[model samples]
Target: MKRFPAAAALLAAVLLLAGCSASGSSNDAGSSVSNPGTGAVTGDGTTKDSGVVGAPQAGDAAGSVTSGSAAGSTSEVATGQRDVIMTGSMSITAKDPIKATQDAVTITEQAGGRIDSRTENPATENQQASATLTLRIPSGALDRTVTDLKKLGTVNFVSLNASDITQQTQDLDARITALKTSVDRLLTLMQQATTTTDLIAIEGTLSQRQADLESLQSQRNFLSDQVDFSTITLSLYSTGTVAPGAPGDFWTAIGAGWAALVGALGAALVGIGYALPWIALVGVLALIVILIVRMSRRKGKAA
Candidate 1:
């Protein structure tokens, strides 16, 4: 009886072990079939996963980090540093337009600025002399330069305007980065290409991307310049002043009047010269009529 019980217990234990092994094998097969080629199958019939496939690899991870940092830096550049285009206009009555313009040029140069355009009108007897100057001033010193300019003459008008291009600049930066990436990818593809046809195609795409990158770079440079420099359009008018003369005022006026009289006489002579030809023609025609009338009268008397 004892031997029978012991044999039964042994058979029961072997069957239990076989059942556990079969269950484990089935679970492993199920895992292999469920998550094929993904990861190692664990004893629990689950995948021992690492990183996900098609995700950013180590090399690409660095680039992603750099891109994120660049994006953050761009955001800061857009928000913290303002891209503002400033323009100003001022009208002043100066005692001398020429001197005022010269002084304005000097001031602008001293302020790390340049004169973009300048126009001067000469003084006339009926009109005051004037000058219009377009100056580009450094934004940092614009206020001080404006104050210095105001001291040159009586200010008639003053205006200032500011335009913000922060969003525009950010958008351009993002576009430039994308274009640069595309250009790099195209260059890589070109290097890898073996056939001439493939090379030509990749080169075309690369050229286009490089062109777009350069264009965006140019726009960024222009925007940066505009933000750095402020425009000032200054209009200066001369205050017409006649100086008091100690010696030559009377003689100068008398000489001027004499010149005017001579000019009038010369004009009258020119008019008479032009009319003389017509007058001569009329006199000749009248003389011819008189002769013809006298001849007709003599003929009638004879008849």
Candidate 2:
């Protein structure tokens, strides 16, 4: 009975040991499968953590950068200003064109403007005087100046035009900035170059960029000036009676008489020229008829 009990106890201990060994083997196989060739378990854990934490962080950084750039562009577009050029033409009838022209010049000067050009024709015996003026006025005071000028004479014609150059100006500004940056970079490169070939190449590029920048700047300045000042083409003509005793009245009268005489003589000559062909045809027919009648009489006498 004692041996039997001892054997049974040994059998139980063996079974328990076998079960523990199987469990350990299964765990080892699973660990090998999870981490294939890597030896460090800690490293695997660290890699897992970093992937979980770093992926969202990188995505967020990229998204933030993109959104910031978008916001900056939106703000720039929202704040972009427009450049406008204004021009006008006006025709006025006045009693005296010279006086009206002077008044227009004075008004332009008073409005912080200037006359770009002016022409006046004095009154003659038969024709009224006229004047044409090109004026530059402040854009802000264009309406007021035009109104004041209208008071000088009757408004025969008027035209106003406006052009928006915002896009053009913005494009020029961007080009200028880019060209300047290119020039600066080229200059820096030229300074750092050790070889003559490199220096010459960089210098050539730099000079081209600088010239482009200057041209863009000039265009921008011209656009800015057009925006600042408005142009006005004003024409004035006499509406009242012509003065008979003007300085050139005698010469004008003589010219008029000579023109009328020449016109009459030309008309008479044209009439004569048109009739000559018809007159020649009639004379030839008459001569033929006379010859035919004489030939008939001679034939009758011979018979």
**Top candidate by lDDT:** 1
Residue 245, candidate 2: how far off, in angstroms? 6.1
Cα lDDT for residue 51, model 2? 21
User: Candidate 2's C-alpha lDDT?
Assistant: 0.65
lDDT of 2 by residue, 1-303 (tens): 755554443333333323433343244323321122121221212221222213224334333323443333345567864578999899999988899999999999999998889998998766789999999999989999999999998999899999987656655554444345435534544454555554554455456556656876998899988898899999998887746764457887798779889999999999999999999999999999999999999999999
Over 4 Å off, model 1: 1-70, 77-79, 240-303
Most TM-score-accurate candidate? 1
Query: Which regions of candidate 2 are displaced past 4 Å?
Result: 1-80, 243-303
Per-model TM-score on C-alpha atoms: 0.61, 0.57
For model 1, what is the alpha-carbon lDDT of residue 173? 57
Worst 10 residues of 1 by lDDT: 41-50
Clashes of 1: 0
